[model samples]
Target: MTGFQNILTLYRENATTLLIVIVFIFTFSNNYICKILPLS
Candidate 1:
Protein backbone atom coordinates (compact mmCIF):
# COMPACT_ATOMS: atom_id res chain seq x y z
CA MET A 1 0.00 0.00 0.00
CA THR A 2 2.81 2.41 0.74
CA GLY A 3 4.45 1.61 -2.61
CA PHE A 4 1.22 2.27 -4.42
CA GLN A 5 0.84 5.63 -2.68
CA ASN A 6 4.36 6.58 -3.63
CA ILE A 7 3.71 5.72 -7.24
CA LEU A 8 0.59 7.82 -7.26
CA THR A 9 2.44 10.82 -5.87
CA LEU A 10 5.17 10.47 -8.45
CA TYR A 11 2.65 10.23 -11.21
CA ARG A 12 0.97 13.43 -10.10
CA GLU A 13 4.25 15.33 -10.05
CA ASN A 14 5.21 14.11 -13.49
CA ALA A 15 1.77 14.96 -14.84
CA THR A 16 2.13 18.55 -13.66
CA THR A 17 5.53 18.85 -15.27
CA LEU A 18 4.22 17.43 -18.52
CA LEU A 19 1.39 19.93 -18.55
CA ILE A 20 3.77 22.85 -18.06
CA VAL A 21 6.01 21.62 -20.88
CA ILE A 22 3.05 21.31 -23.19
CA VAL A 23 1.94 24.85 -22.43
CA PHE A 24 5.43 26.18 -23.04
CA ILE A 25 5.66 24.45 -26.38
CA PHE A 26 2.31 25.81 -27.47
CA THR A 27 3.19 29.38 -26.46
CA PHE A 28 6.60 29.21 -28.12
CA SER A 29 5.21 27.83 -31.35
CA ASN A 30 2.53 30.46 -31.58
CA ASN A 31 4.98 33.31 -31.05
CA TYR A 32 7.45 31.88 -33.58
CA ILE A 33 4.83 31.49 -36.24
CA CYS A 34 3.47 34.95 -35.64
CA LYS A 35 6.92 36.50 -36.08
CA ILE A 36 7.37 34.71 -39.38
CA LEU A 37 4.16 36.13 -40.82
CA PRO A 38 4.01 39.75 -42.05
CA LEU A 39 1.38 42.05 -40.62
CA SER A 40 -0.08 45.09 -42.30
Candidate 2:
Protein backbone atom coordinates (compact mmCIF):
# COMPACT_ATOMS: atom_id res chain seq x y z
CA MET A 1 0.00 0.00 0.00
CA THR A 2 2.75 2.45 0.83
CA GLY A 3 4.55 1.80 -2.41
CA PHE A 4 1.37 2.19 -4.39
CA GLN A 5 0.66 5.53 -2.76
CA ASN A 6 4.17 6.70 -3.51
CA ILE A 7 3.81 5.76 -7.15
CA LEU A 8 0.49 7.56 -7.34
CA THR A 9 1.96 10.71 -5.91
CA LEU A 10 4.86 10.69 -8.33
CA TYR A 11 2.50 10.05 -11.24
CA ARG A 12 0.34 13.00 -10.25
CA GLU A 13 3.28 15.34 -10.05
CA ASN A 14 4.68 14.20 -13.38
CA ALA A 15 1.26 14.50 -15.03
CA THR A 16 0.95 18.10 -13.87
CA THR A 17 4.37 18.94 -15.20
CA LEU A 18 3.64 17.26 -18.50
CA LEU A 19 0.38 19.18 -18.87
CA ILE A 20 2.11 22.50 -18.31
CA VAL A 21 4.82 21.66 -20.80
CA ILE A 22 2.25 20.63 -23.42
CA VAL A 23 0.30 23.84 -22.95
CA PHE A 24 3.44 25.92 -23.19
CA ILE A 25 4.53 24.20 -26.37
CA PHE A 26 1.06 24.49 -27.95
CA THR A 27 0.78 28.20 -27.17
CA PHE A 28 4.30 28.83 -28.41
CA SER A 29 3.75 27.00 -31.69
CA ASN A 30 0.42 28.79 -32.24
CA ASN A 31 2.04 32.17 -31.85
CA TYR A 32 4.92 31.17 -34.08
CA ILE A 33 2.54 30.03 -36.81
CA CYS A 34 0.49 33.22 -36.58
CA LYS A 35 3.60 35.28 -37.05
CA ILE A 36 4.57 33.34 -40.14
CA LEU A 37 1.13 33.47 -41.80
CA PRO A 38 -0.12 36.67 -43.38
CA LEU A 39 -3.03 38.41 -41.69
CA SER A 40 -6.37 38.16 -43.41
* Regions of candidate 2 where Cα sits further than 4 Å from its true position: none
What are the per-residue Cα lDDT tens digits for candidate 1 across 1-40? 9999999999999999999999999999999889888762
CA lDDT of each prediction against the hidden true structure: 0.96, 0.97
lDDT for each residue of candidate 2 in 1-40, tens digit (9 for 90 to 100): 9999999999999999999999999999999999889864
lDDT of 1 at 21: 100
Give the Cα error of residue 14 in candidate 1, in Å: 0.4
Error of 2 at 40 (Å): 12
**What TM-score fits each model?**
0.88, 0.89
